[model samples]
Target: MTLPGGDGPILTCEGIGLAFGRVQALLNMSFDVRRGEILSIIGPNGAGKTSVVNTITGFYRPQQGTIRFNGQDITGLPPHRVAKAGVARTFQNTELFAGLTVLDNLLAARHIFLRSNILSCAIYLGLAEREDIRARQVVEDIIDLLEMEAIRKQEVGTLPYGQRKRVELGRALALEPDLILLDEPTVGMNLEEKEDMVRFILDVSEEKGTTIVLVEHDMDIVMDISDRIVVFDFGVKIAEGPPAEIKKDERVIRAYLGEG
Candidate 1:
């Protein structure tokens, strides 16, 4: 559905509720990821931050509420369908193909966009060659954007931890998603790596105009990169606003920083 924002949100989660047996994971979790904007979801560990991402991406179906993307109801859809709907995500852990070369991993991500028949690919037909070239061009572009051109030919497993994370980001971008969900994109990185991630995220939003939904624990990074922030605690939303407003929110302070 079109959000209150004029450009319309690329994603909207309304009254989202989920339960894992007796434990409530999320309740009435509502928010909008505005078109071409970065929306950060922040909370302490086990505050259902990742659950919100899973619910939106169809990894887990919410027992209540609706999720809409580009004005279409996407709730209950399968993960692949949600992905094909222009929503792409990266796991908190780098999920790269360990043995695959960086370029190969990126090509794998674009498999959904490939139309060549298996027989043609196996035989290396003219049509398959054309498809391969097109896919390679896309991968090359992502390499440049993510600054992985130098390592494109290297095996992903041989790359350092920070480079592997970048490869994961590249794989996600290869999906050509309109909205990208980043789950702790900078987690486990050094300060320099975190700075690079923050810069890249901002560049992606500004240059590519891709909407972003980020679940981040780094408050400084979140505050610096996000256009808006959503705070959650005990499975419920406590505050939602711009970075400045959220920083001053008492609920957010109590939930994250403890009583002060």
Candidate 2:
């Protein structure tokens, strides 16, 4: 797509291995996500696509290998620490707070950026008040960007599945992250919802200059949105390249596309 940020990768994973008991979820997995580019990880069901995301975000630590972000070694950092390091993610399943309003859920993500202490918050003045105001402004801007102004006050649990997914994305956006790992962002949405998500993802990349790591099963969407595609199978990386090259890769066609 001829995007910018040609300097180097924003995130790098090398020789990553993860195993749960006898099942190896990943094996010697390695890749680089260039700054300000959308990189898609595509594989069949149970191919450890989500496992890669979890490992990168620190939900699951790799038994071996290292993960680096922006020239810093972030391997094995806890999820909260990862968030604080300017990395954010949306889950394959929506992880919104069921009882909270959309606005509140989005604001909660800004907690990592809050500088006020408990005493200041209780006083409701000075730094605490200023931080609160700024946080709300960020949340409100996200709500407007995602077209969620109509449901800002609505409870998340009462919303439809598609809307809930959008809220999850909004919450991740609230982090103002440098890198965003999106696992199946449009998996269960209608065509229109998927289109909207693709648009928002592109906007986040182009307008905000955010680097994206997308794991999706929809080949059409993946091919359309991804600047580079990585294919995996049974915990092993089979191929990696631009969409057009990946489309005709023999190993990818055999292992992932289910063709001879």
lDDT of 2 at 55: 97
Runs in model 1 lying further than 4 Å from the true structure:
1-4
Which run of 10 residues does model 2 get worst, by summed lDDT?
1-10
lDDT of model 1 at position 195: 88
C-alpha local distance difference test of each model: 0.89, 0.92
lDDT per residue (tens digit) for residues 125-238 in model 2: 899889989999999998988899999999999999989988999999999998999999998889999999999998888878889999998889999989999999999999
Model 1 scores a TM of 0.96
For candidate 2, the per-residue lDDT at 260 reads 41
In the order shown, what is each candidate's alpha-carbon RMSD? 2.2, 1.7
lDDT of 1: 0.89
Q: List the residue pairs that clash in candidate 2.
A: none
